[model samples]
Target: MASSRPKNAPFLFPTFNSSVLPDPSRFFSHDLLSAPLPTNSFFQNFTLKNGDQAEYFHPYIIKSSESSISISYPSLSHNSAFIYEAFNADITISGSDEPDQHSRKTHLISSFSDLGVTLDFPSSNLRFFLVRGSPFVTCSVSSGNSSIKISTIHAVLSFTGNSSSTKYTAKLNNNQTWLIYASSPINLVNDGGSSINCGGGFSGIIRIAVLPDSNPDFESILDRFSCCYPISGDADFTKPFALEYKWEK
Candidate 1:
């Protein structure tokens, strides 16, 4: 499928370049690239000493930073915000068909809380994006205290075929806030499904605003960006998150 590009700045998606990307099939994964990116391309990437890597992406740009893995790209607009919340679900016990079979899913999300960044904006003209061209499913680890901490440090998408959309709601006095509805959503490669072998590695970057909300009902950006995840339910991780609001407007 062709990448449906974003507009410069519109009511819904008004904070990015409007160039349409070539068919996703035409884009090659980094594992296949044998050398540096073309001088004029829009894709950019950085790999850390410990092998941690993320990409700096424009509509047509691609890059590979093999030595600098810790740097991050800040928001480009005054009304931008960036947020990342993830939980590493580890299994303490495997489920078996036997009567005594046991299984337990423990949330490892909070254990690595210090790995994320929270940027604040004064007003609500927010635009957010998950940058790297694709989502992650498998990554080889060499840094962090142990080898299993690869995706844990970067908030890489869950490899278990789980897609989650979260809604955050709050209540406020009489006012109107449309940041959530007005913001942009980057529809990235879905579910990490193709299993293209690249040393079990993938990269992604998300963009958010830190400016003030043009509409006043929302006092702080966090109030709207915070998400609520259910502790437990007989539900698959495939949940389409709708918005939840406290109602200031």
Candidate 2:
């Protein structure tokens, strides 16, 4: 009898050696060679206690700075109303590869760290830093309030359909879900005698929040999220490049 599996079918379990992995630097631009690569992160829409909601569509980058972690929305327009509403929060991950026999799953632990916000407008070549307060996520600009403490917790990332049209969630260890909302943008003043509207390119803001475990109407809130970013490719995973790997015992 002949095997029924398709010749093009992906391996049930694919493994690769370190040498087989592509260099990360090749994905970055030449000018950025001197700079550190950005961490690709995602956010979704979140609702407030007052029935207010904010939406996010495109992926953002989280860059580490000397004093804080800067979250940049590279696709948003500089004039977007939700610019200032983007703030920053600390994120610490702790987990091992070992899986739990009972749950049959490996968990990723996440915790809060001291954080601040930085907004970058590449088109306008402008940058802003917020050290006071955020409209969404609860965080402090200073060393962070020691009185308010969020215990070490675990989070899970939930994917919906396609990668671009998916929801990236951070569920707490107690099974509570949190949200990071980016509200409307605020007016910018010409402090440096430069026109604030000089740049017509995309703008990036940093604002986020974690919803309380009390639970809000997530079903309705998620519906309000609109995708502002453009989808270039089909709704399927890209085909992998042809490569051969030798399995070792």
Candidate 3:
């Protein structure tokens, strides 16, 4: 008339226990502006798993794992070219050499498990699409309403299995300025190469809307191009130009 059971036994029947899944909405399409793209700029939408969508300004999207991606539009004062940067892992480029070929194009996408960085022209605009990766540090300069500001981001995947990407804007400002997004973290230095105290950051999707500097004071700007050589074409896909970060510390 009595029944006995194991105190620590595994369940054999299907249980109603539920597990929490990651929500892409928190990180993607949270507060996007419906404002149209400016001249010489375009908007491209990407569909992630679960059918969620995110829109990016530039044509290229840098997909990576184990490392973060950085796309730079070095200021006109520094240079007139675009840069694509990645660190701590390997990646590959997808999309077309001439994305302008179509107005709204969607390539054969897959599960977000591969690592790749899409490289486009040497034009003055650069954007980054970071996949899974470790903490990456980088900075950027933005100008708004005659005010110039430099900011940094420390993007890291935390121990809680969630990602952290925070943008820290610098307090400095100017009347008219040039916006520069470094392909890598920049170390500010004096004339003698002594390091300055500019803060550090991590590489993440650059969401700042960047416009080409209409005016530049070339003389006052520090020279970071002595180590980089120019590529002839408008960034030929077969022979894409590379700009190594001169101030890696």
Candidate 4:
């Protein structure tokens, strides 16, 4: 005879172990880029336009957690040189059991994540993550018969400490070298009561140029970020720069 179970009797089945399942959080907690070196890191100090001082660290690390991508710095109280802007993209999931659930979601993105590059300073125990956002550099390239213009962002990580040199260099992928020069005077007072100029800027005016040796057509590179950074009238790509940093003084 078949056994009859009570209406509220607990169903007996094989014990499923959730430990064997893949952890979704682990996927987000991984490092996006890392290059370990000695503890002797290189850093520079700069005064903000509002009269506040901050330190910039080179050879930094980029790590992503469940919520945001963090650019690790030596000091937690350091001020950011440039404005930090967060972007969002809409993601649609097609194959979902429920029509309302998982239909769409907004994903947060970093402006510098797409064009970020890592560089190592020779003889220094540091690796710098060079990245930037809006106020993009518009490049005018001459093709066979037409001129193509592309807007992209790049960062000036450090300067070649030459007393007589004013040009700052940034090396990108495929052996591309970018030149950065101060368009305006950068005056900052350090803690030592000395005025410093002609170094790096936490937030100052500078000009950028792409060498002819590097690839002028950044269409392929920009295509990779089409979803995150759409070229629309309201998008950051259309603006020269956005100042999100507020100073009290």
lDDT scores of the candidates, listed in order: 0.21, 0.28, 0.25, 0.27
Residue 249 CA displacement from its true place in model 1, Å: 30
Q: How would you encode candidate 4's per-residue C-alpha lDDT over 7-121 as one tens digit per residue?
A: 8887665444465433222111124223221122221111112111122322223332221122322223334675542321111001111222331221111112233323221
Top TM-score prediction, candidate number: 2
- Model 2 misplacement above 4 A: 1-67, 70-163, 180-207, 214-249
Q: Best to worst by lDDT, what's the order? A: 2, 4, 3, 1
Q: lDDT: which is higher, 1 or 2?
A: 2
lDDT of 3: 0.25
Query: What's every prediction's RMSD, in angstroms?
Result: 21.2, 21.7, 21.2, 22.1
TM-scores, each model vs. reference: 0.18, 0.23, 0.18, 0.19
The positional error of residue 120 in candidate 3, measured at the CA in angstroms, is 21
Query: Residues 112-154, candidate 3, lDDT per residue (tens digit)?
Result: 2122223222111222322222112111222111111122232
Tens-place lDDT per residue, model 2, 96-199, is: 12222343121111111122223222222223232222223222212111111122223333311223312333444444444432222222212222111111
* Number of clashes recorded per candidate: 41, 12, 9, 3
Model 4 collision count: 3
> In candidate 1, what are the lDDT values of residues 152-221, reduced to their tens digit?
1122232221133111111112121111111112222222431111132112222222123334444354
TM-score of candidate 1 against the unseen true structure: 0.18
Which residue segments of model 1 deviate by more than 4 Å?
1-42, 47-166, 169-249
* Candidate 3 weakest ten by summed lDDT: 156-165
| 98: Cα error in model 1, Å | 24
Q: Which structure among the candidates has the greatest lDDT? A: 2
